[model samples]
Target: MCWINKIESIFNSTRCSEEDKVRFAVFMLKSNALYWWNVESVAQPNVLQTMSWEEFVIRFKTQFYPRTAVRQMEEDFLKMEQGNRSVRDYTEKFIEYSQFVEHYVSSESRKVKRYILGLKPSIREFVIAMDPATFSLAVNVVEVTERNKNRQGEEKVVEKRKWEGSSANFRSSASFRRPKFIKSDNYSSKQPPARTCPRCQQVQQETVNPNRKDVTDAERQVIYQGISLYLKGVFNAIHLIIFGRTTHN
Candidate 1:
């Protein structure tokens, strides 16, 4: 019917002659037919020939828009369900299907009830609990519910990601604080302190005065002993800082 009205408006507004208008209208209708039955009906030359544009439209409606067809559309509307679609999409489908039975569900209350009944169970309870008496109110409630549900889901995801991120950070910090074990060729529970030569220490200090002779092998050994003592002190400091444990002498 809408298609017929649109085509009629176009021809009526144009300068096309009555004959041209009827021909164009029939051509458009024939070209738009979907099934083989429709195609065969439109292909019949005598079907709508010699009729005015207005008479052709009347005949077209009489042939296609039967009362039984409207009843079938109403039955299809009753069987419609939201299924797994989003609330918004389901609402659109509900409105689209209701057009067929718009005359039957004339009152706001009936439209509201019919629309809500087809909604998914997840949102249907809350929508009904609001006790919406009109179709607009029911639609508003469903839209709000969908928005709030989406927001809460997003919040939960964000919270979970934050918790996981914090846990990773804590583990990273703990790893930095963890002690490192030092392995040696002769690993022992305790390490021995370096031995220093007091005589060579005094000799080296005296030799720096420039009044002493060249250092002897025994004095040089003392110098090496002093170097080992200094290195051992450094190793102990490092072990305490990194491993939080002291090397026992």
Candidate 2:
């Protein structure tokens, strides 16, 4: 009976199906002892040489198997997000298996991520309303909200004003501070009349219109409006194009 069992074992080992072989390969990788010498590559050279039929099967569920699976998962995730591929249409397929992938980006895979962008009010309200988190998850979420209160406020204000209208307020900060690069004394000139204005030749019109002496207050208003609209349109067009290119890229 012992002799027969040994013969049967040898026969079964050689006759293992390809699925069993691959599964065995996965198992062998999981054993750090099995991979003691070589791990730079995913392949299991030691398994081919020393593993018995049963030991290989045991190794498949050990620590190293997931790493191999993750590598394969990463390749699949990259192909899904290229330009021609619509993110919504194909992203679902990748998302279902993304957790299996190795080293996928936090924003992409989302298993372990530092929240760079805080959730919007609408999203937060929805998450809180829906299946409330398990106790631990709830506590962590509250902690995150507390820590990011200032950042969240900034994000909300930015979103609220980004496109409703142009944000015209200048940000005055230390970034705007100048140390008087070329110092000038605060003194006034006493003399004038190097060149007389071609139109307003009598009164001092150094900063005013030289070619329109008879221009009335109403005409000035019209000119200012036209110039303001033209400048606004130009600046708006330039900023719009810059934003569009940056977003698309």
C-alpha lDDT score of every prediction, in listed order? 0.72, 0.48
lDDT of 1 at 158: 100
User: Please, what are the lDDT tens digits per residue for candidate 1 over residues 1-112?
Assistant: 6676678678778867887776677567544343533554577756445667777766666667777887887888888788878887888777765655767579999899
Error of 1 at 30 (Å): 10
Candidate 2, superposed: residue stretches over 4 Å from native: 1-69, 102-249
Model 1: how far residue 207 lies from native, Å = 49
- For 69-182, candidate 2 gives per-residue lDDT tens digits of 756766666554323333233334444544444245444324312111123443344336443324335335634554466578889898889744443333345555676654
Candidate 1 lDDT at 49 equals: 53
Off by over 4 Å in 1: 1-62, 66-72, 175-249
